[model samples]
Target: MQQAPTVLHVGWMSRAVDALVRSGAEVTCAVKPADAPAARTVCARTIVVPDPTRSTDVLAGLARAGLAADAFDAVCSGLEFCLLDAAAIAGDQAGVSRALAMRDKFVQKRGVRDAGVRTADCAVLDETGAAATALPSFPQVLKPLDGGGARNTFLVADERELTAALGQPEFTAGGGPWLLEEYIPGVEFQVDGFVEGGELRLMSISRYVQNLIEVHSGGLVAHIVLPPRTHPELYAKVRALAETAFKALGHHDGVFHLEVFQHAEDGEIVFGECGARVGGGRTDEVVERAFGVRLHDVWARLATGRPSGVTSSPGHADDKVFGGMNLSARPGPVRAVPSAGEVLDRPGVVYAEVSAGPGTVLPDTTEATNLRAGLAVVSGADEREVEDRMRRLADWFAAQVAQETSDTAG
Candidate 1:
C-alpha cells in the first residue's frame, strides 16, 4: 500500500497541523526558528524556514529551486497574511492552482463585489491627502489593504476622531496600501466554510459581541454560534449570505472564514472580509464541539483530494452556541498575580490560555489579542446558557487582577 502522502505546511505550528494529523497524513512543517520550539512539540518533524514575512522575492527564489520537491505531496498555507507568496511557491512547486487571489485587499474586496455580493463601500486610498480629506461620515473605518486580525484597523466617530485616528501609529502599519470604508453598525457574524469544485459548504456562523466599541478595537470577542433555533429566519439568512460570498469569491477546494455585519435596526447584512482558510483563535474547536462537524479534518481531506465529511445534524445550527473570548492586560505595572485557573473551571469552558504571565509588560497596539494573551472557548446547548457561561468565565478572570496603586505599599 502507498504510504500516507507527506503534506508540507509552509508556516508555523497551527490548528492546520493538528487537522492534517487527524486525516492520517504525515505532516512536516516549515517555520521560523523562533517558532521552532513550539513546532517540535506539535509535529513529528520540523524544518526551520526564514520568516515567511520578510521578503517575497527570497521566498519565491527558495520555492523555485532551493527546496526539495521529492519530499512532500502538496503545499498549503493557513493564515491570511502568509498565503500569497507561500501559495505562489507551493502552487509553483506542486504544479497546483494555488496562486492565491486574497492578498491584495482591493482585489479581494473587488472579487467579492464582482461576485454580486454586498460589501462596505471601500476604496483604496492611494492618494493619502485626498483620501484623508474625503473621510466618510462618523463611524467610518480605515485599515491596511492586506491586513488581518484587526491589525492596522482604525475606527473614527467624527472628523476630529478620524483625523486623530489616522495620526495613530497603528494606521500606518499597512506601510502604503490602505483603504477607507464606510462603517456599518450592526451585529457582527463570522462564517467558516469550504468550497469544492466551485461548490460551497457552510460550516458554522459566529455572532461576535465586542465588549468595547468599534469592529477593530482589539477588544474582547464574546460570540455564540448560530443557525438560531429561536430565530430560524435569521439563521437561514446568515447561511445563505455566506454561501453567496463563497460563490462570489470563486474559492474552491479549501476553507474560508468570512465575516459579515447585520444592521442592528434595519437588519441589513454587510460583508466584512474573508480569510481563505480555517478560522483562527480556537474557532475550529468551538465549531466542532457545537456542530459536531470536524472542519479541520474536512479541510485536510479536501486538501488531499478526498471527500469532505461535512454535514449538519437534526437541530437548528444556532440551537447550540460555542465561541471564544480574547483577553488582554490593562496597561500598568503588575500589582498582583492573576490566576487563570478559575477561568478554566467555568462550566462549558473547554479551555483557557494566558500568554502574558505575571510581570510581563504589554503595550497597546492594533494587534488583536487572539493569541497574544489567551482565549476561553465555551459551548452549550443554548445561546443564553453559553453566553452566561462565558460571562462567568470572564468575570472570574476580571476579578483576579488588582491594579497597582501609588498610595499602597509595594
Candidate 2:
C-alpha cells in the first residue's frame, strides 16, 4: 500500500491544520519544544523548533537543527511564521530556494519591483536613526521585516511619532530587524490563494476596516468583514495585482497571503506586505463562508500530493451571507467574566471565544479597534443581519459580565 502522503505544519495551531486534515493527509506539526503538547494535539508527528528567544542563541541554533531534505512532501506555516518557509525549502531545497525571500520585506519588494510589478516604496531600517535617512516620507509604516499577525506594526504620522515609535523597546531589533515605508493610504484588502505546479489559483478576497489608528495602522487589533459591500472594482484590481505578486515572489506552489491598499480615488493598488502561507485568525473560515470555497482544504490536499478537486470560484450570487467580526470589551482590570455558554447563546452570535479570564488585566488601548477582550464570529443572510447579531451579542456579553460582577459584590 502506498504510504499516506505526509504533510508538515509549523509553529502553533491554526484553522489551516484542520483544513489540511480534512483534505486527507497525515499531518505533522513543527513547534518549539515547549509547545509540543499543543502541536501534537493538532497533528500526528511533532518536530521541535530552534528556541530563538535568547539573544546569544537565536539564529545559530536554527541553522544547526534544520530539517532533513527528504522529510515531507510539503511544509507549511501559519500566522506570519517565516521559519516554515525556510523549513519547507530545506525539505525540498531545489524546489524552494527562493522561498525565504517572501518573508523579508525589503527583499520581497525589491524582487517584485525588479520583475516590473507595482509595489509601495519601502526600505529595511536596520537602525532606528537610519529610518529618517532611508525614507523621509512622513506618515510611514514601521514594522518588523519578518513579523506576522499585524503585531509590532506602526503608522507614524509625523517625524516625532516615527522617532517615538522607533524608540519603543518592541520596535527595536530582536535578533531579526524591521522595515519602514511610505504610508499607502487606501482601503485595505487581503488575497488568500495558493499555487499548484506554477498555476495561480485565487481563493478569497477580504476587506479590512480599522476602527482606530494606533502604532500599527494595519489593525494590530481589528475586524475582518468579508464580501466587501462597497468595493467591486477595487477588489478586481487587488486580485489581478495579487497574481502578479505571486509570480514575482517566485513561489510556484503553496498558499500565499498578500495585504494591499487600493487608493479609493485613484484606483491604484499598492502592495503593503505578504506571507508565504495561509492567513491566520480564522481567515479561511470567513472565506469559506462568503465564497463557499475552502482554502484550508485545498492547501491540505496539495501538501499530501492529493489533487485539489476544486473546480471553480465561489459563485458570486450565493444567497447565504457570511461575516466574521472580532471585538473585545473595554480594556481594564476585568472585574467580571461571563460563561462561554452565555456568550454563545446571545442572539445572532453563531460562535464566540473569550481569550481573557476574570481578573485578567487587559492591555491599554493603543489601538481602539483591537483592544479585544475576546472575539465573536457571526454570520447571517446579509450584512445588516451580521451587524445586528454582533451588536446584540456585544450587548448580551456586556450585561452578562455586569451581572457576574454584581453577583460577586452581593
- On TM-score, the leading prediction is 1
- Residues 1-410, model 2: lDDT tens digits: 13466665655555667776666667766567777776677687666656423212323333455744355666555545444453544455553446556777888888878876777788777667677767856778887776544567777888889889877877554433678877777767667777777776664666554422432332333234455344577667776776777777777666777777777568688777777666655566666666666776776665456666677644433564554555455456676667666676766555667776777866644444435556766676766676667666665665555334355569
Hey, what RMSD does candidate 2 come out at? 4.5
Off by over 4 Å in 2: 1-3, 47-71, 82-91, 94-96, 171-176, 211-232, 330-335, 359-372, 384-410
Model 1 lDDT per residue over 192-258, tens place: 7677666665556677766223324545666777755566777677667667766655566777787
**Which candidate achieves the best lDDT against the true structure?**
1
Candidate 2 lDDT score at position 367 = 48
Query: lDDT per model, in order?
Result: 0.65, 0.62
Q: Which residue pairs clash in candidate 2?
A: 153-216, 154-215, 221-370, 328-373
Clashes of 1: 2
Pairs in steric clash, model 1: 226-318, 227-318
